[model samples]
Target: MLKKVISKTIQLPDNRVITIETGKLATQANGSVLIRMGNTMLLAAVVAKEAPEEGGFSFLPLSVDYQEKFAASGKIPGGFLKREGRLGDHEVLIARLVDRAIRPLFPKRFNSEIQINISLISADETILPDALAALAASSALSVSSIPFNGPISEVRVARVNGTFLINPSPSLLEQADINLIVAASDSSILMVEGAMSEVGEADMIAAIRYAHDAIKLQCQVQKELMEAVGVEKTIGTTHHASAIVCYPIALREAIYADLYAVAKQHIPSKALRKEAFMAVSNRYREQLAKDQNGQEVTTTQQKEWLDELENQAIRALILNENVRLDGRLLDQIRPIESEIDYLPSAHGSALFTRGETQSLTTVTLGSKFDEQIIDRAMEDGYNRFMLHYNFPGFSTGEVKPNRGPSRREIGHGNLAMRALKAVLPPDKENLYTIRVVSDILESNGSSSMATVCAGSLALMDAGILVKAAVSGIAMGMITDPTTGRFAVLSDILGDEDRIGDMDFKVTGTYQGITACQMDMKVAGISYAMLEKALHQAKEGRLHILEKMAETIAAPRLDSKPHAPKIVTIEVEKEMIGAIIGPGGKVIQEIQKETFTNIDIAEQGYKGIVTIFAGNQEMLEKAVSRIKTITARPVMGEIYKGKVKSVLNYGAFVEFMPGKDGFLHVSEVRLERIENLEDVLEVGEELQVKLIGIEPKTGKYRLSRKVLLAPDVVAAGG
Candidate 1:
């Protein structure tokens, strides 16, 4: 039987088109779609369990995995395994992007385990596949029988030379000052995440709006393709429960007043506030049991009602009374305190605390050899700057086991890295490989933002010449659905984030936003609210930066005493071999003598040499040796020379590091010398002057009698 292949096309700005085809591959999957543009193709296959996991999950069990096949780019995987083992950070980030966009579109009561796997089967150098992952995943859902409220798609918007390009080529993306990946349904934006070069609030919103326009077109294409495939939304076929779980209205009425009172208490301690709320909830549970006259109340039922009550009370208090759980007004930030050099032995360290969240961050500098090798399917490069975020369970006052970095940690660290990477000095000026690690010692909310603040401070303290200090703030929103009254909270707490409608984080210098990420739990967020959040987040960020400035305003004059010092020099391309000598012998000797590390790369007509040493003295020694090796031999220039060999006719002396010259027997002394070894033994050091070069051999000539006194010459004659 012939397969029924269906495809749809989306025409974008600049006449670029993306095609989505179904029924061609992965036929065993519940739904599968292949999305392609400019020779780049991503195959997204989604599978959903008909029933929930054994116990029935309280939350949506959705997982998204994005992988890139080395065969996609016609390259072999690195490492001894010679195959992809685990998902790299980059792949995890892309999976997260897709997951965030489609997660909210699923029904709240549907707890089925859904897995979306997107693979890059074909790679295009100019066109990146990350921006297409979400589109493919959503398209797969659209064609499936799964109950989804989405035909959403994502697009990349980049502003280069004042023009906004949709899903631009990689080269264009590099020159973009405003880069954003926006996910949206046909009507509303769902997710926004990307980095910028200090772009303003208005421009950021405009970019999102611009991206949504393209997304609308792509979403429409998915809808058309789904219709063409004739897949009906059969909710009952899958274990999708459409019923809205309703709690006892009487229970809510009885507990809401007390919960609101507890919320209004302005309890500063997280633990205390939690206890107070729990007391009211438990009291209500007892009252309900008494009202029912011994009706059994399961913990799940009690929790469900209590959660509903707390959500109502906190949101009501904020909307009606204009106060938060901690009694701060809307748009108000929590207290901030920061310190630098907190760890005595670290190259650089800082402790940044905002309210209950704290990040103890440290900076480590290393040589080029320390750079992280990125061997991916589409690209092979080195990451000189890395930020690792560690969130131990103790940070949140829990007893969780340490199981390496989770997806959340990697995502947080990547955001912080992007936030500060824009402010780093050029590679030529800063040669050391930099790694910033953030350990969350205490966390209530926005620990990732604290990492940004602390990482900036630590980088500066480590004598890294950062262009500007960066800070971050997590903004939240609470909306009254009945009245459409919304409040944008700055520097939100853990409770606010849990109950809030939006978690929007912005990071940047004082000027504008450098990086931003927004995830909405609500159906959608208005652009006006987004703009308000951006500006509010900016105010909070600026305030936090003020606290940071009080600790360390700028980079130190130099790195710490124990930190390695790096110096770079350039030489003629032809001299690169001479510096390395026969199989790196010369470079190795120089390093051994000066206690330094050296690396050289040939670029264009020059060779770049980087030297890493323990101190200024050792650095100077290595630099001098490299200079001598690369320096050109000049006539009439005197130099300290080492005799490499003593022959009967002449002594072969190294006038410069790699340049050898012949010193005639007569040139060694004012009088005739029968044996050159008598005056100049092998490995002897002497002073000589470069005289001339042999016409055909390009050999150098050296002389020693040119500086002799006239009286001494007359006496010898």
Candidate 2:
């Protein structure tokens, strides 16, 4: 046995070098690669099994898994088990990044089950592993003998101070106005996901082009690595993986006329149009069998050809006829309707329906306890805002068992969150935690965009002072590579999405874009085409926003009367423990007596306190109590207190939260008393004034006569 190691290095714009090597650890896998940048290291391995099992699925079964080891960041796993648990949100999101980049590159009919596993072996917080994971997975596929037309790579471009930096550090990301992730092959851009602080479209395209150059270089490196390793992707040919996939051209031609007519019919119901197309196809198949014309083709081949014809017909109609399946023009958007306060008990709710898609969205405002705490290797914090999306089978007119939210739901929810997050007020202005949930009631296309529309209305209805309203549009593209013509379709339908080359979802306000995602099923689109799509999307978004304004123009002036009010106050940080008291005695008494909720945070020099109550009366009462707890008695100031103890010549009176002042027998009352206990009992209340204080002893001298008449005090009455 012999072990050989070879590595390839690429230089980044910042003069930093990254290296990827094969023949390292996990060499026994089909293909293995370890990528390193600075102290961060990731190992990716891929294995494919041809025709492993027949589960009656036509598409490739690709399983991508990304895992992070706590030890990689020099920390032990959290929780009682002290081991890695289920897949985290970041892991799922990153796995999707890798899957989207490589899934489309597999040979058209290659249906093998491929598993790509990427693990974080070593890492530093500075170098992000998410972008590298995609490169490693693609590099492994490239060097393996698996049949793929890819050597794709993904990069994260972050704009800081108007300059785009590739894969910026954690601290740098904080300063970035735009954080964009791009996955691409040498010649094409495959996937894109990004969030911006209201960045413009031109700037976004420039960042993409910048990322395009870096992706091309990485793809070249992968090709060189594959050449050096002498690995050729002939798995499909060797295993007969796609050997039987042939669409009969004659059958396609026979069905083209009817399919084109059906595509142009503009049927309002998607199901009806789909059924009509199927019926026509069945009739044609019977005619062909009777004539013994296409009987030689297998049923699979016939079905495949029919589907191709449908896709081709739809594309041709859009490109040549300048019409969509729904009969709208290229730049036209579907009809939209929106309503708010649809749910009585919800903090806020809205229903937004566009064409056939509908979303029922609700907003819930919570407290600090509701914020989500994330614990991961490199990223650990609390997220104050969260958005959840759900889609059921019935939404699309199907009868399937409901399991749970799929990865698509999470990804869609994340996009909506990004779109709405930009409009949220600063944390200080809005202290309540916000959660937005969008449930799809009907689905024809772009339910995620519908969610965005509904979420904005829900936020406003909930009395959240968002900076601006946000809307979204899903744009589709029909490209004719040979003819050099393309049509950018706005508000695309599900059918168009299935056959179209691009699914570009843009979300924002009228001024600029907040978040966007574009996944390409075809080769790279030029910047000009992207610009056209963006402008079209903007137009569609504005149209949708105009419709939304009719329902609710802005956030309500006040939250629901039932909603609790939160009043925040700051006290000296050193007084926090005392306010809490020993064993939580003092604060508990105040809460029980005042019937209010209190939350505290220890800031630098002060303790931030928030009081939650049902009404203004309770809120003011709680505030007064807290002020008493933090208030200090000043010399020559009058105070009303309770006598906690009686001494031989003096009494100890409790004034502030825990402060006590000594009242001498001479200052016990306006008249002279023989004994202190005779005039002052242990449980009596009195009004006193601080006369003097011993600085060193920190003791107070109080006189009750100050609050009484001066003549009465002189006469000893």
Candidate 3:
């Protein structure tokens, strides 16, 4: 078959062009598309099983994989296998971005195990593939025969020097104060995840709007591409894959009053509230059994009916009577308790509990050797600030094996890391490699936000000197599809998150937002609603911040007494080799003698030397030794030196830590010395003067005769 490729080009605000083409790759799949921007190319292919998997599923079984091949960047894999293993954190994050963008666009009952795979086939050093992955995924779905409500697109908008640029280059993005990845359809935003430099709400909104405009253009291109390909989405008949059982109005009416009363009770205990709801469900089940003359009812069907009833009852209580599960106002936050220095052995630790959710966070400081090495197809560097989140099954009162960090765990840790990174001291001032680990001890809802609060407090407790304290809150929205009425909830409960239309989390300092993540379940949510959510989240965040401040308002003036001390010094690049010496013998001797750790890195013409020591005395010793090594030699200056080795003709003396000078037998003493070893012991220390330096060999010449008395020298000769 002839491959007829159709292409559409989009000109960016910076005048760069991106092209989207179909029919050139993976045509046998349900849908496929290849998108190119600069030298980077991404291929997205989507396929769906004709029918739902056996045993059936009520929700969409969508799986998204975003992979970056090492070959794409003209490099090979690093590990022994020489093949890509499981996705790295960076790759997982991009896949999550694409998943969050297009997950809501599919039909609600489309449970056909749909899989979207995107590959970075070719890469450019400057262009990031995150937003393009989403766009290509959406375009592939648009050209497929499957039913979808989207031709959505995503753009990474950054504000550099007070101007917003759409999908800026990597270098340009580094300079941006406000960086966001926004996913949107032609009309409304579907997902948002990014970090900023404590940017205000208004500025964030402006960035999102700016990105939406660019997203609109990309979405339009997908539409035109679909039309050109003559592929119209097949409006298949809606099939209830699980054979959903809808209860009668009489049954719902029977349970409505009781369910509403239970929901209105405002039970603060999650376990109690859950039990009460279950009691109500059991009553409904018994009534249904009697109504059907005691016929056996499928457990799944009965549970589904009861779930729907509960959703309706809780939503109505909130929307009609302004009553929440916990009796808090729509903008009210849960009670927060925070404490710092909770662990004696840890460098820094904090216990943050907000309502039922809690995070025990700890901070550790190390030298540059502790920094994490990131080696990927497109990006290679060291990450000094790391945050690891762990959610044990016991935290949620469940029994499950611990297999390691899940995708959700990684995503949550990343969001918290971004939030706290904004307040960390600049690289120059903060020299230690920092790691923040949050362990969930209890979870009800918004545990990631709790991690943020605890991590901030722990950092302060560790004397990190953060620019400002950061706090986070989760916001939920419940919308009346028919009436267009919506309620924005602050610090929502787990149930609200499952039943709500949106799960929006905002994190920031007192001045502005630092990081945020939003996922929308419903379509066409107006900007007004989002604005309201942001404002409400801000209030909640401030409340949490006030509570956190009660524990520790600012970073501690000094780190713990047991913590390691770091000192940095800069010297000329020429001095680096002198300090390291041949085969690293000099520096190794210094570290072994001083009992300290040292690292050296070159920047331009200067070398940055960092020393980590146990105490001030050790730090001083290391610093002084490095100074002596890099110190320049002066002519005609007498200095105390140690004899490193002895030879027949002469002996080499170490004038400095790594600087050695040749001392001849004639210069050893005023008298004639026959045996150099006997005259000058190998490990002896003596006074020597810098007489001259041989320019040809760049060797220093020292004289002991110059320091001897004039009469005594002549008599000895």
Candidate 4:
């Protein structure tokens, strides 16, 4: 017998319907929901394998998979390797988004092995899979017995020409100056990702509000689905609320005042700030310990009090004095200094520093064959241009083992890549493979934005014809409605990002936006605020661009000497066998002789060979060898030949055709010769001319001498 389930569906204004089917699939799982919007559909299933072990709540192992099958888009897998194998960048990012949104929803002790799978059955391209995946995962966990707090919803808010567009189409997104994906749990924001030309705090807040309101209907559907078929939620773990202890408010106020006074005396450095705070915390702890009441305080309680004091001091410093810990104004951006051509051997290189954050971005150009081939469960394609961000431990004054690129690096690189994608030349006849590597030498806040600035300069230094120079800025916001106050900060600092409500990063060209990412710690923002932020961001971005242009106006026309030289050749189908010989022998010989890298297409008609050397001379030598091996010999050509044999009337001359031709004694020289050996010798090269062909005899007639003076002939005789 089939189990009956409750499901709800709502039609969006864009003619797309979102459906939440519950208790229909994956019944054993904690929560399951299948969401279908337009032609795109996703089935999200959440299951908690086990609860946390004793005293082991270090981290959450939440595995999320956003899989895409070739069949979903009516396409077959390409390449000799016929299967999708790895998780693509897109898949990893979607998984990260879902994990970030749902991980915080669970209680602290609920360390369950949460596994959420989002399978894309169809893809319409207009509906982004990442936001939908986050929504489905949140709803699925809510209706499950996995002890989740409740349902959550996500929406993509884009601003185009000062208008807020919720869940805009992919094409419309191309024109948007700011794009933000916000995930909320009704009252508070859980996750946010955005990019802009250089949006300010106000516009970013507006986008958050637009997305929050736009997702209301979807949230309602999730609630209805839970009512219809959700399993009974498990009771949350019980814990006692911390008891409030009275400390003299005047004493607390005095302690904060003294702390700020001491903070002002110290220089603004991360170490300085840490030491100052530690000293104040210790002084307060000592004072509390000596109280006559002898009220005992746990270390945890003392630490919490210290944290609250620190937060208050920092907030007060920013709000009342309008001065950051670093002594910068509320809206003053950090100092930026950029330089291009920093590396001698790089095709393009730039060093970008904003405040203490620094990044060295380098660009490399190669042939189309150098493009990265992606084989993933979600998507399969080739990317000619790639951006890689590297953050070493030393960049943050930390000690950690070095390994391959981390998830954070990948995500940041992808964000930069997306922001610059709009300005890249189309992948048509221009088939150069471009790769950019951004190394974060120092980081305080918004290193990714520094990467963007440095990357644009590096591309120009490498001679890339970008549409326009691009720059990025991180905007921060602090809003206290109780005081009827709000402050929008430009180029936020690390502490500002930590205590502030939002980290809105906007990157774009001078013409418009190219990429944007926004994340908020508070509830959400309004549309009006987002618009203002975008406008401010554009101004900030343009200022940064001006500074960058002073160092390098455009990409360099010449590449680095160390880079390889690519030479392409097209041969006939039949000649491919000759080039390859037996088991690639001929090609291997060419590689060995020329010291060149040869990449042959599987189709055998086209080949791209890369020659790497110190200069063009070596490259030319390699090209010459390949041309000779593949050259077609021509008939009736005058060539230097060696005399192989001598006859009574003529001599046989061996030419490059691997055949011998006759040189008549009468035509051997202008003067008559008694023997062929007198005028010519074996193993000697002699100039021979093709006279005519004796068709009846099928022999070639060649001559060394056609006419001579009679007197010279008589003298020789």
Distance from true position, residue 453, model 2, in Å? 1.3
Q: Model 1, residue 514: displacement in angstroms?
A: 0.4
Give a tens-digit lDDT track for model 3, residues 1-717.
799999999888889999999998999999999999999999999998876667668678889999999999999988799999999998889999999888888886676788999999999988988879999999999999888889899999999999999988899999999999999999999999999999999999999999999999998888889899999666353455224444566777879888889999999989999999999887766665432444455676667667777899899999998879989888888888889999988889999999999999999989888999988999888999999999999998899799989989999999999999999999999999999999999999999999999999999999999999999999999999799899999999998998899999999999999999999988756799989999989999998899888889889998898788898999999999988889998889889989999999999999999999877789899999999888889998878999999999899998766678999999877789888878887789988889889989989998887778687567762
lDDT of 1 by residue, 1-717 (tens): 788999999899999889999999997888999999989999999988877767577678899999999999999999899998899999999999998888989876777788999999999998999999999999999999788999999999999999999999989999999989999898888889999999899999989999998998898889889889998866442232213334466765768888989999999899999999989876766555432444555566567656876898899888888889998888788888999988988889999988899999999999998999989999899989999999999998899998889999999999999999999999988998999999999999999999999999999999999989999999999987788899999989999999999999999998888999989887778888888888888888898888889999999989999888998898999999999999889999999999998999988989999999988889999999998788888889888899999889898998887889998887877788887777778888888889999889999999887756477467752
RMSD of each: 2.6, 2.6, 3.3, 6.4
- Model 4 scores worst on lDDT over the 10 consecutive residues at 235-244
lDDT digits (tens) for residues 1-717 of candidate 2: 777887899888898888989987898788999999999999999988744465334667889999998999998877899999988877888898888777888876677778999999898888999979999998899889888888899999999998999988989999998998998887777888989988888999899989989989999998889988889665552222224444456755767888999888988788898998998788887544422332365566567657877899999999999998988899998888899999998889999999999999999887777789988977778999999999989999889787777888888998999999999999999988899999999999999999999999999999999999999999999999998999999999999999999999999998889999898887567777888999999899889999999999899987887666677999998778877999999889878887778899988889999987766778889899888888777887878889999988899998656888888887766688888877888878888888888889878888886677777557763
Count clashes in each candidate, considering only residues at least 3 apart in sequence or on different chains.
0, 0, 0, 27
Clash pairs (backbone) in predicted model 1: none
Better of 2 and 4 by TM-score: 2
lDDT of 4 at 100: 63
Residue 536 in candidate 2, Cα distance off native in Å: 1.1
Better by lDDT, candidate 4 or 3: 3
List runs of model 1 lying over 4 Å from the truth.
237-251, 288-295, 632-642, 673-686, 706-708, 712-717
Say which prediction, candidate 3 or candidate 4, comes out ahead on TM-score: 3
Q: Which model scores highest in lDDT? A: 3
lDDT of 4 by residue, 575-620 (tens): 5566676898877776677666666553445554444433456668
Q: State the C-alpha lDDT per candidate.
A: 0.89, 0.86, 0.90, 0.73
